[model samples]
Target: MTTVATSSPVSGARRQAAEGTLGGAPLGPAERAARGKAARARAPRRTHAEYEPAPNRADPIDVIDRQSRSRLPELVPLRYQRMTESPFRFYRGAAAIMAADLAGTPTSGIDVQLCGDAHLLNFRLLGSPERRLVFDINDFDETLPGPWEWDVKRFATSLAIAARANGFGPSQRREIVATAVSAYRTWMHRFATMTNLDVWYAHVDVDEVASRLADVLGGRGSRRLSRATSRARSRDRLRAFTKLTEVVGGERRFASDPPLLIPIDELHTGRERELLMGWLGSIVGRYSDTLSTDRRWLLAQYRLVDFARKVVGVGSVGTRCWVALLLGRDDGDPLLLQIKEAGTSVLADHLPGSEYGNQGERVVAGQRLIQASSDIFLGWQRVEGLDGQRRDFYVRQLQDWKGIADTERMNADDLTLFGRLCAATLARAHARSGDRIAIAAYLGASATFDQAVARFAEAYADQNEADHAALVEAVRTGRVSANEP
Candidate 1:
């Protein structure tokens, strides 16, 4: 995380008007990156409609085996080797693999674009210098449109995974899953009353979120809530950036490092930088409206201050990611953008629909449609590899005051409240896409799905444990490698 400029109370009126109402701007490479401070995005985006599917083996699992074998992407086999360690551990990862598998699964008649990995751990609070704590879904690499059930099932399964990771027993996990399902059901019932603007305006702040969690979990769970929130606040972008990087001369920049945030000076010496820059520029034009209108304004306003290739998330471990530091207005006015490679969605293999112009754009669009409110600058792009390979991407601020209370750290009471809030929030998201009246009808009066999900969760926990053991074995045999960074 790097320091971000604190926003003044710029009218929500103007910001809202700027969305949809404002025309997009195109920016040339020289103008946008005079100092190269923003997230680099010079790649061509291939919407699903344009995608030429790579050949896969007769069996889909073979796809992972074949792809992982090539080591074309960062450490895929190693990631699975790590996932094999525990279903609970692996459950945190069900997003990617499940998405891969889901893309290949038989589907229901009903579908809406989805956040393929809508798990419990994905929600968090991002803070500003003004100390405003806003909670929202933080990851979109696996975003896609698919069966609505996929999102709900994924969210349900995540509750099970988090409970197991928290060291809760079978009975405990079941109860938590039920809590989540029921909360979702109840919340959707109320969403019908929310005005369009209200839905867009709805967001949870840290203090308010914590108090709600405290009411539900109580005792041990409540205590855990406090701990998780404290840890989250400490994860400030500037603070994390300082710990991970070093200052060279007068610049607040990163030290020379391998596979982490690397300095441009070190990169320009190698041909990869030029290739990357070209692709980044293309991605910008395809994904960002700024390329058309604000490119010159942005170019004159900011310079690239720093960048790095970062590894993030349990599932996103091996993917390519870069974080750019921008100095705007002056050195103190800063913004951090994370430019990550958006591979095909996990759900693409299962319930594929819509030939999107760009998968990354699909993600950005789905997120905005589903979320009550989205990052002001959220956008996507296509990046072309020198090898004629290309990947799509959606970009945004890395973390303003983002925080999540991990399930493992919660007390029972906090867990209950956390469960409710997450459940309700998820329902709100779903309502944004599909008809709530129908979904509410489908969930009418009974806790059957809640109960069914709980049962499925207990069974899945057993599977997770077995898988975790397999990963541990792989690590011992040198079949895969794992590292913190």
Candidate 2:
């Protein structure tokens, strides 16, 4: 086995090339492949299988606690409670922990706009701007420019953990992880041969994918896919408006559900309420400036009616998330937009800081670069809080054909198929922002990289189990408080 280098001259050049500022004319495919072969020699593919924790590795619980300091105090425990539900749930909330660990791992030094938190659950069916159902990555909270392998490792490990939750044996688990890695390798190779425009336009249409897999999915998996696609198509703005609002007296208002959803009026009163409403209303106008001309014109038609502080997702429970209800023309025409707080990515400390000053812009820029299609209303802004602190936020439709896969219901075959879909989607995303030819060259036409990543996934899954156990112990001994919401 080749020993990994702490820093290499080749790695530095690769990073510069990945950033598209390598101080030279564009390299042809042959030169690019040479650079990739050099990277492979410097960091052998087999070296990726290693996963021994450093003696001075940070405590996972401490990392969780540090992240909580910036979050709502009351809701931090709920984040912990949600994570403690299972090892898979724990993995979902533990991206920071994994990011810290991945810093010590070997990489090809290839950088891309990473999803940061690329767990399998984050890949799902979403509505494209054209209203077609597409399978793509939906989360960008932790997105940043970093090693492509970090996203791949995070995704593969999530598969291993989820397999364990479903009672899969070690062999079956390895197969599942390898299946995804192989798909990534295969897709990257395919992308290497495509034109830049083609690569940029490549996307997975859920309907097309369903048609392709109809034979292999069998009746059960086929039905599940149909239901998922149906649910996604039904989750448009109208559906969100109907489910989340009610007629209060004479006007539509956000329904109040404590802990999960609290109306703005319920949280503030008197002069404070008046000030908050004004600030939130101003945010709509300010955020609209970030959108394109057509989108801005469209947004100008909607009046901000109501907003609420809502608890959302496992890791994001404590972070400030607001759902705004907007109405156009009359009471019946509505748009639901979510304004979520954006913080520094979990990978920030491990890699270089983001070039965008506002974290919200960082997220928006990343999403636009990586996703083939994005929400029409996606935009960002900075707002001053009642406490006089300023925070960055990104706004988008609250539920635009969003559908998450139910992992618990998936059998081994179902998961393997889902893994393949996620892997291909991830490859397409990476290819858009990184050198596809070089990455494909490093992966080669071999099973070595795939097998090594599968091994690493299983090993890291074991480490994740230990970390989850530590959190559970902390809660049991009252070192950390965990309250179910």
Q: Which candidate is the best by TM-score?
A: 2
**What tens digits encode model 1's per-residue C-alpha lDDT throughout 242-301?**
565666787777566655456655667567776666565555434455332443345346
TM-score of each: 0.76, 0.96
What's the TM for model 2?
Answer: 0.96
lDDT of 1 at 20: 14
For candidate 2, which ten residues in a row score worst on lDDT?
A: 1-10
Backbone collision count in every prediction?
Answer: 57, 0
Runs off by more than 4 Å, candidate 1? 1-63, 66-85, 100-108, 127-131, 193-197, 210-234, 256-260, 264-300, 473-485
Q: Relative to the true structure, how large is the alpha-carbon lDDT of every model?
A: 0.59, 0.89
